[model samples]
Target: KADAKARSSIMLKAEAVSRYPSPAAPLAYGTAGFRARAELLEGVFYRMGMLAALRSRALGGLAVGLMVTASHNPERDNGVKLIDTDGGMLAVSWEKHASELANAPVEQLNQVIASIVVAEKCDAASVGTVLLGRDTRPHSEKLSAIALEGVGALGAAGRDLGLLSTPQLHHLVRMTNGEKGAGPYVGDTAAWNSEQGYYTMLADAFSALLSSGGDRASCSPLWADAAHGVGAPKLEALLSKTPQLQVAVANTVGTGPLNDGCGAEHVQKARLPPRGYEAPLAGRDRAASLDGDADRIVYHYWTKDGSWRLLDGDKICALFVGFIAEQLDALALEPPISLAAVQTAYANGASGRFVKSLGVPVAMAKTGVKYLHHVALENELSVYFEANGHGTVLFSDRATSALLAAKAEAEGASDEARALAAGRLLLVRQLVNQAIGDALSDLLLVEAILALRGWGAAEWDGLYEDLPSRQSKLPVKDRTAITTTPTEERLTSPLALQSALDSLMAECPHGRCFVRPSGTEDVVRVYAEAATQADADALALRTAQATWELAGGVGEKPTGAAA
Candidate 1:
C-alpha cells in the first residue's frame, strides 16, 4: 500500500521530472555546501530523501527534517541539506552516506534498507516520521514531490514546512521536541540547520534588545537584497516574529541568488555605477543580501569618499569580536569570559592577532567553518570566524554558568588560570548585553570602541597590520591542471608554489602565498596577504601566473591599485 502511494507520488510528479531532468551534475560540494546543475532534480531529490531518512535514524528515530534548495549557489545549480536532531548541522561524516545512497543500485539500495531496519532494531511493520521543506525554485516543487515518494516509501509520516529557510526548519525541529502530544518517541528534533531558524534567532535577539529599552519610534528600519532565493520570505518571517523592528526587503523577486546583481556576492551601493562595478563584489551600507539559504553574510559599508567597502569574511569576524569585547567591558566585566576565537586559513592574520592582543585566545584552522565550529565545540568557544563571513558564538546555558562560577571563585590575586578565571565573570554580562551571533548583530564594535575609548577600525587594523596584498583566480581548460579525482592531489607543483611564496614572504610587507584548486570548479585559487598592497598584488599575480603556466592556461594580470 505504501509503495503504491510512493509510486503515485512520483508518477504525479513525472511532468516536473521531465521538465527539470536534473541539470548535468555540474556541481560538487564547495567549502560551504554542495551545488549541482538545477535540472538534476531527481538526483537531488534522491539524495535529499536518503539523507532525511539517515538523519532520522541517527537521532533515535526522530523525524529527519530537510530543507530543499541550494542557497547562494548559481541559478543553474541547486542543493539539499540535512538538519540534525538538535537543530545543528549534520556530521560531515554523513556526506559519504549520502553519496553511497545516491549511487546504490536498486538491489544494493534494498540491502541498505535491510541493514537500516536491523540497525534501528525495528520490525518490517514499523514506521517513522520525516518532515520536508522547500524554497521557491521551479525545480524545487518537483523535487519535493519526488522526494516525498521516497519519504512515503520509507514508511515515514511526512509533514511539510513550506518555503522555510534552513534555520526555520531547524527551529521547527527544536520546537517539535517540546510540543504537547508531539511524541512518545525519542523526542529528538531534526538533524540540521534551517535557513529560516537563523533569522528567527536574529529576530529574537533584536526583539529582546529593543524590548529592554527603546519603543517603536526609536527603532531603525532594515533592508535586505533577497537574492531571489529563500532569503526574502525568511527575512520577512523574522521581521514578523519581531514586530518591533521595521524591515524592508528588495531584489527578492526574480533575483539569481548567486554572485549576481544585488547580492552579497555582487552589487555594493546605489552609487557604484549600476553595472560593471565588480571589484569589491558586494554592496556598501544600508542594505545587505543573503545567499539562497541565508547561512552566510557579507557587509555593505561605504568608505568616507562614498566608495563602497564590501566587508569580507575577515572584516566581519573582526567586527563581531571587537563589538562583543566592548559590550563585555561596558558591563564592568574583567574579561571573565576568557574569550577564544577560531578562524580558518583564508582569514586575514590581522584579525587573529588583534583578537589575541585583547587577551582572547585564538586558534587557526583549515579553510572551513566546519573546522571552526568543531573547535568551538571542542573548546566550548565563545566565538568563531571564517574569512567568508560564516560565524557563530557559543550560547549554551550550561557553559555560561561554568564560566561565571570560575570567575566568582578566583582569589583577589592568583595564578594565570585564576586571573583568567576571574576575568571570565564578564562573559555572561557581555552575552546578555549582546545576543549570541544575532544576524541583526551589526558592526557596532568599532563605533562602540570609538565612543568609549577613542579608538577605530584602523586601530584594530594595526594589530597584525596587513601588508599590501592582491589576489586573482585563473581558470584552466582541463581538469588535469588540478586533480579531477575525489582524492586530494597537488593542485600545482608544490615546489613551484613554495618558491613563489618564499619570494613574496622575503619581500617588504612580508606575507604568505599559496595555490588551491577550487573544489567546485576547474579554477586555481591564488591567495596572498602582505603589509603593502603592492607586495600583496605582485605576490598574488606571480603565484597565479605560475599556476596558470603549470595548468597550460592563459591568464590576465591582476588589475586595479591596492586600496
Candidate 2:
C-alpha cells in the first residue's frame, strides 16, 4: 500500500535510529532541553533533529531550529535547545514527546517515532526543513552534522549554519518562517533574516536611536569579556558595523577555555573580573561579559571608592523600565498602553520596589526564560529578566501596531514630541531580540540608553542599591526530592528544610531565602539575600548547613528527610 519513496523514507529513518542508541539512563527534556556530557548526547542529537523536523511539519512546514551549545557549561560538555517554529523555545506541549523519544529503547525507537507522527497528525509526506546551528566547540560540528542526518532520515531538509550564537540561529529560524520583504517588516519577523541581516538590523536600529536622541556618545570605553567562545568573533563583527562606541574585547577564542573563570555566569555569580582582567580595574570603566553562546550577558564595574558594583538583570530591568516608562509617557497614547516587568524569584527584592516606584507592576514566574517569556506576553510591553542576566523585552503585536499607527499619524503633524517618542519606541522594539534573550542585542540596548541619558554604569547602578545576595548549590543524591511552590519563593517539600531555612532568614535583617532543584544540574540551588554582605553570606552558609543536617549530606543517608 506504500510507494517506493515512503518505504525508502521508513528504511532511512530506521537505519539512522539504529546508528545512535540511547544511553541506559533515562533523560528528560526539561526547560533546558536534553543536556548532558557531549559524548552521551549522540542519540539525543539525532532524535532531537527528528523532533525538530516533526515540529516544523506540525506547524505547516515552517522551519524549526536546533541550537548546539551548552552555554556557560564547560567545553567538554555540550547540549542542544530546539528552537520552535516561532523562533522561541520548542512548545512546552511537545516537551513530553521529546522526552519519550529520547529515552525510548533502541528496539522501539522506530515505533515510538511513528506513534508521534500519528499523534501530532503529521503526514509522512509533509517533510519540512530543520535549520541547525552550533557554538564553537571541538565536537559541535560533528554533533550538528549528526542532527542533520536525523533530519534527512525523516525525509526533511536540513540547513547547517555553522558557528552561530544561539540567538542568531533563533533569529534566522524566525525569518525563514516569516513574511517576505526588506528591512522593517510588520510584527516581529525580519526581512533580511541571515547572519549579515542580524548585524544590519541591530546596527541600523542603534543608528536610528542615536539619531532620534541627538548624537553619538563619548563615554569611556567599555571592556567586553567574550568567554573565549562563539561570541568573540560574533561580537567583533557586530561592533565593526557600528563605529561610534569603543569596546575593548578580551578572553577571545584560543585565549582560554569556555566559561573558565570568565563569562556572564562567572562575573555575575562570583562578582569578580574575568580571567583576562585579573589586574586592578580602573574606577568608572564599565565591562560586559557574555556566556559561551552569547545568549546571556551581565555588566559590572568598580566604583571610585574601591567598591565593585554589578548591574545584573535586576539593574538592567530598572534602567529599561525607567526609560521605557518615560517613552510611553511621552507618547501618551489614548487608552494608555499597559506596561509590566516579569522576573523570577531570584531577582533582587529592591529591583521589584524600584520598578514599582515607576508605576509598573512587576510579575513573578517560575525559573527559566520560557516561563518568564510567557508571563511577559500578558502586557502590551513587558520586560522579563532573570537574575542571571538572561531575558528580553517582549513587544506584543498590539503594542507594535499602536506605535506604528502613531508614527504614521504623526507624519506631517506638529506634534514633535509624539513623533520623537514613536521613533525611539520603534527602534527599541527592533533593537530587542523578540525571538529569545540575546546578549549582544541587550548590550546594544543598554549602550543606547546610556547614550541617550548621558549616564554610565554608575548612574544605572545608582537607580537602587541591591540587597546583598548569595547563590549556592549543594550536590544531592537525588535532586528531585527538593521542590518548591509555583513561584519558587518558598519550599513546599521537606518541611524540615523549609523550617530550618526560615529560621536562618529570620536571624538577619531584611533576609529572604529559598531553594529549588537546578534544571540543568544535579544539585539543589539555594538563594539568600540580606541587608549586609556578611549577613547574606552567612545566611547562605547557614541554609546549606541546615540542608546538610536534615538530609544527612549527599553521600550519607538522609535521616531526617520527610517527603
Candidate 3:
C-alpha cells in the first residue's frame, strides 16, 4: 500500500508540474543555484522540490534544505539553493543532476525523475524529507507553495520554516542531520534547529565572549544596515537576548525595498555606507551592513576626521587570522594546529600580502563560498572570505578536538593562562557560524574581537590598506567563450585576451586584472586594481573593452568610471 501511494503521489504531482515548464533556454545552476527573475522560477522551484526529495532518498532519508532567496540581488529577483544533508552546498555531481532536472521539459519530467533515481540509486520507497524556507521577497510564499507541492508529489515530508535567513536554514539542516549520531551536534541540536535557537545561540555566544573579557561596558554599540531584509528583525531579536551588545539598526524591516542602495553589496561596490545610514561620531562608532539574505556582511566606520573607511571580506579574514594566531600562541598547545587563509583571485593584492606577512599560508579557490569552504576544510583551521563579504571560519574535527583537550588541560594551569585559554577557545568555537557565512554571527565576532583588542573600526581598518579597485560587468553575447583557471585568477580562453590585459596592467603601478563569466547573471565580470583609484578605473575600463572585443560582447562598450 505504501509503495502504491508513493507511485500515485508521483503521478499526481507530475500532472501538477505541467503548469510550469522550463524556459526555451535552459537555466544553468550557477555558483549558487537557479537565480533569475521571480516570474521565471516557479517551474524551477517545483523541479527543485522534486530533486530535493530524490536527494533525501539518495542520502537514506536525511533531511535536505531548500532556501528561496537571492542574497544581495534586487527585490524582483529570486533563487533556490539546495543544501546537502551535511549542510553544505549541493555536491558538484548532484548539482549537474539538478540542472538537468530543472531544464527537463514538462512531458519528460517524469522520465527525468526516473533517470535520477537510477543514477543516484535512490530508493523510491524511502521517505523523503525536506526543510524549506524563504526570505522576505513578495513572491516567496507563492513560490514556496509550488515547492511544497513538488515535495508532496514524491510522498516526501516537508517542513516549512516560514521565513528565515539563508544561514539559518543551513544551520537547521545541519542540526537535523547531526541528530543522527553525526558526532555530537554543536549547541543543543533541538534548540539549534529552530529560529529562536539560532538567535539564542548567537546571543549566548556573544554574551559569553563579552563577559569573559574584563568590562562589558567597554564594548561599543554598532550601527547596522539590514538591507531592509530579514536580518533587521533577526538582529533586533538577537540584541534583545544579549542586551550587553547594542545595535541601532537602519533600513529595518518594511522600511525600504530589499537591497535598495543598502547592504554589503552596496558597501563593497560603492565603498560607502548604505543610503540613509548616518555614521555616528568618529571613534568606536562602527557600522556593518547585511545583504538581502543576511549571509554576507561588510563593515565600515568614520575616522576621527570624518573620512569613511570600509573593511570588506579580505580585511575580515586578515583580522581573524591575527586574532586566532594570537590565541593559539597564548594557549600554547603542545602540537600546534595548521592555520591557513583561503581567498579568491578577487582578493586585494595588499590583503593577500598582509596575510602572508603573518606567516599564514594562503590558498586560492574559485569565486564562491562552496569552493572556498572546500579549501578551508583541508586545514585544521581555515579562514576564508570573498571580496564581497561572504565567508566564515572553518575548524576541522581535529582542531575542535584539540581545542577541547587544551581547554580541559588548562584547568590546572596558571590562572591567567587558564582564563585566556578558556575564554578564547570557547568563544572561537561559539562565535563562528560553521554552517555558513552568517552576517549576524560575523558581526558578533567582529564586535568581540574589537573589544578584546581594545581597538575601534579605525584601528582594524589600519591593519592593511586596500589597493584602489574597480569591477565592471560587460554584456557578452557568449560568456562561454571565457574560460578561467581553477582559482579564476587567470583567463585561459579567447586566446590573447590575457596577453592584452597583461599589457594594460603594465601601464599602471601595482596593477592587476582578470575576467570571468558571472555565475548568476548573463554578463561577464572584469576586476582591476592599481596603486590609485584613477589607474584602477582606467585599467578596468580598458580591460573590459578588451574582453568585449575578444569574447563575443554584444552591447556597447562599458564606459565611465566603475560605479
Q: Which regions of candidate 1 are displaced past 4 Å? A: 1-33, 112-126, 178-204, 210-223, 241-247, 255-259, 267-285, 326-336, 403-470, 476-493, 550-563
Tens-digit lDDT track of model 2 for 503-525 = 87788999998888888877788
User: Residue 500: error of model 1 in Å?
Assistant: 3.0
lDDT scores in order: 0.52, 0.84, 0.84
The deviation in Å at residue 444 for candidate 3 is 0.3
Candidate 3, 1-563: lDDT as tens digits: 54444445454555536788886678988667888889999999998998899899878899999999988889999999998887778888998888998898898888888677777777666788999999999999899888988887787899999989898998888888884524553557866768888888887887777766777425787888899999988888888887777788889878989999899998898777787655554333788989999999989887778677889999999988998887887877668889899999999999999999988999999999989999998998999999899999888778888887777777656557755764676677767888688898888888888887888888899998899998878888988889999999888897699889889888889999999998877788989999999999999989988887888877677676552
Ranking by TM-score: 3, 2, 1
Candidate 3: RMSD to truth: 2.4
lDDT comparing candidate 3 with the true structure: 0.84
- Candidate 3, residue 103: CA error in Å? 1.1
lDDT for model 2, please: 0.84
Candidate that scores best on TM-score: 3
Clashing pairs in 2: none
lDDT of 1 by residue, 1-563 (tens): 54444334333322222322233533334343455666655755764575576456445566667767776566666667666555556567666555555544444565554444344343233344577787677777777776776666555666876776565565566545433313222122242124444444444544443333324323334356666667666667656666654556766746443435655444321212212233322322244555556555554534445554445556656655665565455434444445577776566667777777777777766555556666676553357755555566654444455545555655433434544433433322232211112232332222222233333333434335444445456776764445321212123344554555566567745576766666556666666777676667767776666665655555554343211
Please give each candidate's TM-score: 0.73, 0.94, 0.95
Error of 1 at 227 (Å): 2.0
- Per-candidate clashes, comma-separated: 49, 0, 0
